[model samples]
Target: MSKRGSGLFFAILLAFALILSACGNNNGGGNQGGGSEGGKSSGGGDNKTLSLLTGGTGGTYYPLGGSMAQIISDETDYNANAQSSGASAENMQALKNGEADIAFSQTDIAAYALNGELMFKDNKVDNVKAIGTLYPETVQIITTKGSGINSVEDLKGKSVSVGAPGSGVNANAQQILEIHGLSFDDIKAQSLSFDESTDGIQSGSIDAAFITAGTPTAAVESLSAQKEIRVIPIADDKIKQLIEKYPYYAEDTVPKGTYKIPEDVKTVAVKAMLVVRDDMPEDDVYAITKAIFENTDKITHAKGKLIKAETALDGIGDLPLHPGAEKYFSEKGVQK
Candidate 1:
């Protein structure tokens, strides 16, 4: 062949090769056909990958998500990746954009997204599904005993960390203050996570900060051991209205011994749920949920979430439970 003809053939071959590679990555495993079968079951396969978007690496969500990945992998055939993200709100947005397959998010965020309320504004996140409620994220109010910060009202003029932008904790703190006629400008503000806020408290750069996490969070554990930190609970009557406007949240208590605090701390809280997009295959969702539930010991115990495997699915909303998860739950009689 002529040199020009040879060059033309080579160019065509390269283009075809690139197109083939792209198609191969997107459509997925030929094993998809054999995914769901008999009572014996098949947990998807090695080729199927699901993503779990979690909060800051220093926070509970990250470790919880990592533990989930491990437990699910051991119990199912699907490979999971627990990705570090900007927390609840960010994870919801990522879910809408298909950036992740599953995520750990606050109950308030899921409610707001589904209802198109508050931060959701015009864009409604209509496809969110809940697998289970992990545990309560207590809004921990830490203050220097000498800071004269006795209540949420006394936070005025005191340093506070609202948490990182786009995080669920920050959003909840914003709602709590606004309902009570306060604003970021009403107090000294610092954008930090539980760990960051703990560091600030240790160094005395801030007088108080809000933390939303399970009991005995490592950061709080360390801080409580050092400073004479107090757990100021959010037990205001206004919380009833907050919960009315958003039903996803409920009343929870930071028990007397959860921290070094001497008394039970009452607070408004929300469940942390593992969410998924609408399009994930039922078998895939079921297998993932099953793996996590069956290996609950691996996740909750590893991360110290203070929970049980079956307890996770206890309070799911009307949002259609993934069929696979439903199948498992139904068999276990958890959904009766």
Candidate 2:
């Protein structure tokens, strides 16, 4: 009885020890795996992935941002993925909140965010720094033929889409109106997206819209296809006034054939730009900026063609440039 019982007890103890050893090894492996996953997700590893915030799918920013992300991922050590967002104001907030590493924004909107003015009143976003200005976002005031809206003054008493609420477009519209001796109170203001504004015009619900985007905007192009649309020219005198008040604005012309209009339409424009979190490593930001400008030809969007190193600082205004971008631009002899 003693020999048999002793052997059985020894065997049971050995099996329990083996089980404990296996459990310890499994726990150690689980921790290492969790850490690796976290590093990849949080942009903390050698192959860091950055979140690049862009605009809605229908607009220029989303497509251009996607192209830029592809360039960054393909050419640099970092991986970037562009996520569709609410554009400028929201993108600035995302950067300030640490939810994004890069974003596409309008120059005027970036100025407003930095200064805590207009839509960003009393809540300045100080963490965003510019990569560079990309292209001009023309402020197109569109109306259908025979709407009797020939100028900014004629917009009085008519329904006009003033862009989405709290958007850069809205601010532009307000400023343009103010310069024209009008205010939102003078018109039936409607807050609508590009697609919604165009649809409103088609359905006769909106008399006109203030669309701030690159020339030959998709929404305006689509609207023109079904109905003859008119891009009302901002008078030269008013444009002068606009530029005087908002130094970020530049006079732009919508070429006659751009929308099949009878003549070139004068307008003002803000620039589209890239902004990055100020805390990004200088080397990483430098690589990102270099990748973008060096590879602009790879970008398939129409606006992408306009992205050149020479014009990178066209309308940056008072927003601070990321050290990385500044480094790249300085190396290229680009003056800020």
Candidate 3:
């Protein structure tokens, strides 16, 4: 063949190859994120990716997910990407839409999504399943110490940021408020994240907001440092009934030391959960779940020690355990 013809032929081959590679990448969906150890590779290649969906950048879920993704990438060859959404509800939606392969969520939201209950009413996410419980999320309500908001009842007529709609924190706050006869109306509602809410209160845009997190949240800590931030104590007797009705909740205390509190602050708490779609390969799910437990230190140091696999890996979430995850726990002899 002529030299010019040979060069043209090579260029055409390169272009066709590039097109094929792009096509392969486009077909991967969310699972192509390449963070799973045993995750399937692309275009029949031994490369994998796993997308982990968590909450807003202002919360624990995002940091915890960052840690998990770091661990996944460090311990394995898969490229893991941690996605940011509006927390539990939005994460579930991402999972259902195949935008994320795995997700970090609140147990209550996970249950609601799985059972098609409140927050997920009228539509069901039956494919949801839990890997394990990560940590407790204490309902943190802080008001300016001098706002005269000494009690939950005092929130009446005050402006409030109850978290973004469809978020687990928002749902929890809403449920608790309704039981207390307070709606978004009784207090002006500001659907903001922890950071935005902090700024809101500091700038006098709002009075108070419900912050459900593993204390001490950076936002709360910063606010408390600049001004007096009083943690509102939930009525124990009132919360008791709520806990009884909501099987996903428990009585958890954000110890005095967690924040500058007078004593142990009692509140209703829920477990954070790691979850995945039911259709994921059992081997892949097992590897992902096991990797998390094996690298508990990474998660603990991420935002808070939310996943103490040995001492605190409780399946407190309402969703059924993923079969792959069940296998990991069984092999480890950790009682579910």
Candidate 4:
């Protein structure tokens, strides 16, 4: 009954115990990873990841957003990345559907999402909130002198490139035409992207195109270099009515020297804004907003745009500022 039997029994028990411990460790590790939810631990961990939804490569959002995403990844523990999207409307929907954590959108589109108007008429996105404004998007209505189309009203019965479907430019085009007493039914409408629209103009397939972008937009610049393009003026009276009704529209003018055109063109403009989900934790949002605000100058210089942190909250339309962003701006003595 002796020492041999006792030793064998002890060895067997130890082996079984080791196997049970190993299994327990494996199960615990799996659960920990699977149970992980939400962004970086608000408790301060580097496990969180975020995605930024930007506009097409031809527009300002993609580059600016890529820079912002880099800043976020470099300045914080969370990993951030940027993705190109179909501009405002798609970006908003991305945020609502959890496809993106942050996005760049035109102020008017953000307003539409919150109020359930226009494209978002039947499906309102209530989770979006403003982070800040990046820059102004001027509504540029371009055409060559040979096109025989001069003003918004002249667009009637003419082929026009409104903008890519779901883009903020398209909405601006529709509203601009309606203000001029023209509708899609009255004009030959073309839903083309900025690059495509410019091509359309160059090919003479498009009489005029509506391009909403920052000053000196690449698409328009290329068109000007290829031909003498005129950015027709949107009369002041219509601009006034637009701003009165939408409140997001601001009167802007393409300076006389902006393009090859000889004269300045009056236009209605909207701000490009950074947005996030309203349900994002205040501290996380606060940290991100603070990082961006503090680096706004660097971002603007690198991006070559008018991105003033001080004026970020100025024309946010009906979209409420995320509490975290509001706090940072408030501390900096930026009212509202």
Candidate 5:
């Protein structure tokens, strides 16, 4: 039992302690780098989780976005959760600010964001890109049967709901009114949400409202069930003029049975589309696009039926499509 033996023993003990510490550090680092359970990986991996920005809970975008998110989760290695926001304009901003991975937007509003027109004027959001168009969001000029508002011109001098402030619907209402030779100044403009507008109409606080959503919109349908509603038809010439000026619009019709209207009503509509950040990987966007279109049947919303690959490019026009989405559409022979 000499000093040499004691020194050797101490050195071996220190070396063993250091080795254990290094092993524990490696294990701890691995666990920390690993993602949360049932969550997307922080490191590069096949699975990812994304946030989808949609409109308010009372609107079509919210429920439709939920369905879309579910579809992506079920069909791909991605988990998407839909979040309710202020709809088109806000959704665009979310994409621009990196707050959201994907979003729903109206074709016209998206065009404006790209070109810095109207609401987006002088503040263009160029970092967003399109996935594909979903369906037509019709501009249904709704009023009670006895409101004496059978046409757009009648809306003048009446209390009207022009949609929520800074919303795509607000922009649409403005354009439609301008085409009809009227402006917000010409009417008692009320900035209200869909539910608010309908409530105002029911309470006789507003005479009419301009709703821009897929036909059979929940708000309008609820109003129709309680009171006889009329959807004012846009005259052929005005429709022509509106389309000529705002090329995003296309001729559309609300069939007779919709809202229990007596006959068909002609109008113009913009397409609702999915948009994403420009920085998303091409393959991820492609998979998302594929999952949405290929599993439309799984979407329970009535508008789900309209989400077809054949019409994905309908009102997309010249807006830049995400390369991933473009690749998927091209493979399906659905070209822009």
Candidate 6:
């Protein structure tokens, strides 16, 4: 072969080799079939990942979030995963920073994030939007049977676990105390999580704890199973005051069988809410909201509580509803 012809053949061969190498790379989980079955096209830049931010490992949010992630993955093409977080306040920051796609938060905290109140202070997170309201978490003021802390007023001059710092529970605890005309100076306040607070109660280090959670709360239930405890009732007058000032506070009754109480206890509650960033695709968010409510049974089975689709629109405060969620609820004939 001529020398010029040989050079031409070599150039063509090099180009062919580069094309084969590119094909090999593409076949190695690139654009085509990269995600697992039922998962999103995460390997490609066009697909968005669904990350659900939940509370600590032992809390209700974590397990419920895991269940929700599974539902999203099974019901939609999004790749969803649940992450352990510090709950409400922290989840809000995560969503705002674009680090998470969905989060579980207390309605009051969501309001605060939206309006720049309480922990949010002067800097507000305006990008957050509500998907829907979940179940109500009763604010239970619990102590040992002999603690003599029968009402909110009795918490004065006592040691109290307000809740962990930077958490929505902490804000609720402070509100309840303030409504009772007591301040942190009136009591020895301890910032602790539910498990930590219960541990303090068990060890006799804490006098009382303001626990905001669902009825038959895991921590409170465990405490009741091992030792007798008292759930202080919030008087109707106090409930009225709380609701008057904060419409997010709702009336809830902890049934007699819940915990060690023999009689039903009256308390105020905050609704748990699912939230998303405002920039999330409306259609995707709509589908997620619909999937969650439409398959309430799946959530109930995973979390052991009935979530009625009809009540989803009831307690979602003034926090702006995601357009997608609003559309879904409207289609169900439910209006906010």
lDDT of 4 by residue, 211-325 (tens): 8888777778888889898898888899998888778889998888876677778898898889999877777788788777666655643343466668888887557999888
Residue pairs whose backbone atoms clash in candidate 3: 32-49, 33-49, 33-50, 34-48, 34-49, 34-50, 34-78, 34-79, 35-78, 35-79
TM-score, candidate number 2: 0.85
Ranking by lDDT: 5, 2, 6, 4, 3, 1
Give lDDT tens digits, candidate 2, residues 195-222: 8899999999999999888877877888
TM-score versus the correct structure, for each prediction: 0.81, 0.85, 0.83, 0.83, 0.86, 0.84
Q: Candidate 3 — what's its lDDT?
A: 0.77
Please report, in order, the local distance difference test score of every candidate based on alpha carbons: 0.76, 0.87, 0.77, 0.81, 0.88, 0.83
The lDDT, on a scale of 0 to 1, for candidate 2 is 0.87
Candidate with top TM-score is 5
The per-prediction tally of clashing pairs is: 2, 0, 10, 0, 0, 0
lDDT of 6 at 35: 30
Query: Over the stretch 146-250, how does candidate 1's per-residue lDDT look in tens digits?
Result: 777777888888789998765778887888887677988999889987778989988989988888876667788888788777877665687787788667677
Candidate 6 TM-score over all chains jointly: 0.84
Instruction: Rate residue 297 of model 5 by lDDT.
Output: 95
**RMSD (Å) per prediction:** 8.7, 6.8, 7.1, 5.7, 5.5, 5.4
Error of 3 at 133 (Å): 0.5
Model 1 lowest lDDT segment of ten: 36-45
Model 5: per-residue Cα lDDT over 65-151, one tens digit each: 999999888766677899989889888978888999999999999999999988888779999999999999998888999888988
| Number of colliding residue pairs in model 4 | 0
